[model samples]
Target chain A: MDRVSLIDRVSQGMKNLLVLMLVLLTGCAQQQLRGTGDLGVVIERAAGRIVVVDSSAHATLGTVEGLGDLSHASVVFSRDGRYAYVFGRDGGITKVDLLTQNIARRVVQAGNSIGGAISQDGRLVVAQNYEPGGIKVFDAETLELLADIPSTFGNNGQRSKVVGLADLPGNRFAYALFEAGEIWVADLSDPKHPQLTKYCDIGRQPYDGLVTPDGRYYLAGLFGEDGIALVDLWKPEQGARKILAHYGRGEEKLPVFKMPHLRGWAVAGGRAYLPAVGRHEVLVVDTSTWQEVGRISVKGQPVFVMARPDARQVWVNFAFPDNGWVQVIDTLDNRLIDTLAPGKAVLHLEFTPKGEQVWISARDDNRVMIYDTLTRKPVGELPAQSPSGIFFTSRAGRIGF
Target chain B: MKSLCLLMCFSLAMQASAQSTAEPTPARQHELIRLVRQDCGSCHGMTLKGGLGLPLLPDSLRDKPASSLAATVVHGRPGTAMPPWKTILAEGEAEWIVSRLLTGFPKE
Candidate 1:
């Protein structure tokens, strides 16, 4: 064995080892390369877990568990769509990583929480709580507490439950105080010191609220009365005004089995489709004038009146008993075009990014039903355990979700 | 002997009136469990710790009279959002639910 030949063989072995390491690294990178744009999460209410789903594939990717008290869980996607902030009924806020299919961080922020919202800049996450009755702002990345604003009202300093939390432009959040009957805007431009704008006496019992797509208006649905309280974000000095007041026409209201959810998608084609508090009808209001333009009778008390992405159609799901049915209305004609029973106890629904398909959660049946919006036919289904609240990554880019 | 017989008959009547004609079948009991866990769980927390409505935990309900609780379930509190369940629940089912809620609701 000559010295030059021995040295050549040793260098060749070193080269081979480097090649092997390169192959292993590329394999690991390939596993994490997929984009999260088509990802979403479905809450398995009874199990206290979330099933991460891929909308493009029409399949569930993975399940993340150990989220406490998810019975009324709502999820919000981070700006990059890589993380989903789940707000649980037990006041737990869990940040789940979509790529890793695991909980990145979990914190029980309060005794009980309703839902949450992410700031416009995506730097902060806010949880609306029922126990301490306030909004707690957290650092989105580390889940560290940043600010706590109690919904305190009255001379006795009673804290009101915060509802209808939605992020607005300029790093602000607008929410309603259920007991105080007020709408407040929290400006977090200075994350350390939050500036508050309070609008008092908005209406009686603002159950939930929604911000328009343009980020110009915030509307709160009054459960104690027959009207909606509207605040134009562009002109806060004008204060909140009641719209569609006395919509019941002095008639007694039917028993509302479940509270209706208000969201920005309720607006379609310059018309907002709102569920009448206790009536089996959906009130159509002209967005410009905020007047009750028409009423479309429905099967049962509507729980969620949402619009498709293109603003061409509106979909409605009813409360129990009638909850097994879903109704669709064509925006152009503003008439009931189709009525379909997707499954038993349809708890929630979410549309795809382009609005071609919609996913409906049938909690009692333990399955998520997918349907073709254009044909109004069942296209696919995914089995879930007592599913509720289907959320998609597309919400990350929207002003209010 | 006559007075003793009368007392026994009155007790029998009370027991018969306190319960439905017959105990709910096992299948009906399962349905009732789901209704209370999911539907009623909406306002009261699923764990029954409470949300928009008052908590229905055993401790919270133990002090209240079972009869009054059952009546509230059947008729509902008028001013509040609790809607009467007379249309959905059968006779004496409310009483059954009150008894169950007072003893810690079943998980299933």
Candidate 2:
């Protein structure tokens, strides 16, 4: 071949190599998700006995101990899919390795660090101190206190409700201040000393706010007011835009004492599943429409709702049912298929990378349970020390062991 | 009998004064009751009589300032499970709540 043709051939070869690498990475992710293809459930069993149950088979698998009395915890995994951090409602974080199935280290976080988020790097963990309503940054691997960032946006005299923290790609973090009606965005690029970048004031009551999968917009779940407020994080100066839905749309005019509470939305197949606290239903919003197109009725007080990647199925857990269980809905028909009765009150649920297993954490049971997706049955359980808000790492190969 | 009657009148006057100072309209009063009984009723007593924390009555908060009391409600004490109230109560609403509490507990 001529010199010019040879150069073009070399460039073509390099392109093929990149494509092959991409395919290999995607396959490896699928392999890690093989065992946890369904759903993993975490239950805070009565009396703080944290256990993880295979939700499909309803069998207990892993166990952890010494989550203090009244020590309800919210558990989340690192971004790189290596560590599982279980945060006690009172103020302690138990860092566990997903690979080893063991508590790698434990750190006593300050105040009531109920909600947290892992950095994109999976090296730093930032949690919201519930009581004082401050921010605590920890070294994910060492489980050591790196910094306790007191919230300036949160007034000391005001009741501070820091409900949720979400990772904004890179090392930046976003947290919700329910009391102050504000969302604090901090740059954790420097994990040691996280610098406060922006204090985006959304409105009167902000519950749980999260950036879009693409990190373009930040949406806050408003409880004190009607509808979900959207903040243009890109042009944050423009303030928040209220995306009114049927949930709390007419709340101000309704004589009935019904207000939106504990609202969450999981984006899947270009749609969002938004559910109100008191309402026994789920609002389906087409992200493209920004309009409420459909609603699904779910029995019991469904608080936390999640959807599978393909948007084929949606999982919702009750907040008030005395016994504790999850509601599974088929998105195709928008109907309730089955109720996941795990015998413990579940506060939060997370899905494995490949959308196979659903992971649930019960504050009262202090355990994490895993459920298979195919059969919707309990297969195994991971003992979490007072687990609550559960999230998993879905970066690459690191997944449920 | 006369002394008892006088005490009753004094108590009524105190309550009336409390109500007037807080400037709670009948509607606002009803809203406050609903919140105290429902939202806070789970942990704090239904009547704000203090289940998890101390009572919210005048007798309980007589020693504390209205601002301090309001602050506690807005920004729950650090290191405790008491969640901050910024999201629950607005600034004006919190101050009004504190004012109502300072005026003395209403007799149910």
Where model 1 places Cα greater than 4 Å from the true spot, the runs are A1-30, B1-22
Q: State model 2's lDDT.
A: 0.62
Docking class of 2: incorrect
DockQ metric for all predictions: 0.47, 0.02
lDDT of 1 at A308: 93
Candidate 1 clashes between residue pairs 3 or more apart in a chain or in different chains: none
lDDT of each: 0.91, 0.62
A293-389 per-residue lDDT for model 1 (tens digits): 9999999999999999998999999998789999999989899999999989998899999899999999989999999999999999999999999
B9-58, model 1: which lDDT tens digit per residue?
78865774576655665777899999999999888989999887789999
TM-scores, chain B, all models: 0.79, 0.66
The segments of candidate 2 whose C-alpha lies over 4 angstroms from its true place after superposition are A1-49, A52-62, A79-82, A98-103, A154-159, A199-201, A245-265, A321-325, A333-353, A357-401, B1-108
User: By DockQ thresholds, what CAPRI class is model 1?
Assistant: acceptable
lDDT measured at residue A154 in model 2 versus the true structure, 0 to 100:
42
